[model samples]
Target: MGAMSHPHHPGELAAPDPVRLLAVRDTPLSLDEVFAAVGDDAAGGTALFVGTVRDHDGGADVAGLGYSAHPSAEAELRRVAQKVVDDFPVRALAAVHRVGELAVGDLAVVVAVSCPHRAEAFAACRRLIDDLKSEVPIWKHQNFADGTEEWVGA
Candidate 1:
């Protein structure tokens, strides 16, 4: 589907659809929250994407990491998720991002998208995660044994 231009809103862009969006502390989030936001009577297919921190990255022997976000990160994340919903046939959607100190194998982000069709739901779910990683203001900090840290964009 072609990307439609969302009418601009004063002080921000238009947000036509956002079942849920949040930025929370680095901890295990409630799966119930995700399910609630992406649940709808009309949806027959639901897709979920959970992004986790791995023990290593690019062959780096990293110990752990942290994530920081600008104050407007949550709003931006909402916008992105909403856009996916608007562009596709998504019936409901939810995006949650974790910040602060994190350990290996922790959940970093979770994106759930539901739609009437399985293909659209799957496609929208992938797009939601890819765009979140590329466009969101969230950052990742990688720590090594040498006490060095590196901050990278999400």
Candidate 2:
């Protein structure tokens, strides 16, 4: 899709593309989709981050995890993405967090940032995921192999 255009007053250029994509969905997340959203001719580098469910956490055997998001989660994601764009020299950006049950190795989140250089792209991508994890209202319910369950990042 083309970059969205916003209304601008006279003598003002159009606003730069802030975030190419931002979403919270119950279905599995896709790295390709996120990467494609940030594809820009002006960008010399693109950084991508994919977070997946691991088999273990804190030395405990994790069987799987179920992600749940508050009603404001999507909005919070957009807020976080926009912050990264504003703080960095980002040409384009995208972020998606997955909800619903997921097995081990399944993707939990995917984020991408494109910039004029590798350093900025990497920094912006890192900031996007870090802020999203810290600010977004998402919880993880982990199922352990030992027949126990725990809630994390609530």
Candidate 3:
């Protein structure tokens, strides 16, 4: 019971935060870097996710897209990562999101999580990406081949 309790609770120990990397960059994302950042000797499982720009979306032919992030985007991203570390037994975690113009098939984001088991790693990685997408102040401007444009999550 003592070990299971959180530090905020009376007589409990605080676990070290497991966020290893967090970034919102205008350059292309690197899967290797993200994966390496989450490497942990104690971790038996590692889960990784990469988001890529596709040529089509919602029946429209996407020509390209540009991502723009608010000044606080990186800080918000760290908050999301910290939440995942607190909720899961994350041994290590990393995430990087790309900004600026990206062509179809470009890597838009890369995230990885390592844990003592496969299930935990997968769950943490999923939650990290989901929360980042919804909570971060990153907007996407998509251009269609038909000369149409749309803003998403602005």
User: Which segments of candidate 1 are over 4 A away from where they belong?
Assistant: 1-18, 24-27
Candidate 2 yields a Cα-based lDDT of 0.87
Of the two candidates 1 and 3, the one with more favorable TM-score, higher being better, is: 3
Q: Put down candidate 3 lDDT per residue, 17-55, tens digits, no spaces.
A: 578889999887888899899887778889999999999
Ranking by TM-score: 3, 2, 1
lDDT of each: 0.77, 0.87, 0.89
Q: Model 2, 28-130: lDDT tens per residue?
A: 8887788889888777788999999999988999999999999999999888888887888888888888999999999999999888778888998999999
Question: Which residue pairs clash within candidate 1?
Answer: none
Pairs that collide in candidate 2 are none
Predicted candidate 1 versus true structure: per-residue lDDT over 1-154, tens digit per residue: 9966767322132124546545555567666788788887677788998887787777677788888988888888877876796688777788888888878888888889887778888998999999988888888889976677777874
Error of 1 at 51 (Å): 0.7
Give the Å error, residue 136, model 2.
0.5
Per-residue lDDT of 83 in model 3: 91
Model 3: CA > 4 A from native: 1-15
Q: Order the candidates by lDDT, highest first — what do you get?
A: 3, 2, 1
Report the candidate with higher TM-score, 1 versus 2: 2
What is the lDDT, from 0 to 100, of the residue 137 in candidate 1? Answer: 86
